[model samples]
Target: MTVESRRLDGNAAAGRLADVFAFDATVARTRCGGCGTTAPLGAHHVYADAPGMVVRCLVCEAVVLRIVRTPGHTWLDMSGTAALDIPDGDPS
Candidate 1:
């Protein structure tokens, strides 16, 4: 995955991602990288920051994941889970 260094405000970046992925909203899920346990997660206290952007396990903040939007659907870069597959729109 190509990580763009260009900086974008959290809201704008999230909006762009949502538009790209065609998702109404992004869900947050935290999982333990070691144990593979997952749990519901909430927005960080300061989501605009990099550390705040992480999704950590409720029981153990061992695993941190970031959810990003794709052209077709939402995806978790860490777990490689895609919410849905969307076809590209025709330009014609």
Candidate 2:
């Protein structure tokens, strides 16, 4: 599919990310394994209208993350990501 077909912003991932992250994941930092590029989640291309949520690398157009929710649990695939740094919000 074309890039336009896969175009969705990070905000669309909020609900899906809420299941696994405590803070706003759109603001997190991640390293793309495909391109070895690091960028904020908001900068990644997020497709949430599909059967599952998919996050792609802007540089290489490779999938950097995916989330699939099952009736019993949620599955997250980060095979395309080298590292993900979720900030340790306020220590309160």
RMSD of every prediction: 10.7, 2.4
Identify the runs in model 1 with alpha carbons over 4 angstroms from their true place.
1-31, 43-48, 67-76, 79-92
Collision count of model 1: 0
What digit string (tens of lDDT, one per residue) describes model 1 on residues 1-92? 22333332224335534544454323434344545554333331113345324443434344344555446666554452222223345559
Residue 23 miss distance in model 1 (angstroms): 5.8
lDDT of candidate 2? Answer: 0.85
lDDT, candidate 2, 1-92, per-residue tens:
98698588766777788889879888888899988999878788887768888988978879988999989999999899899888878799
> Could you say which candidate leads in TM-score?
2
Any idea what lDDT model 1 has?
Answer: 0.39
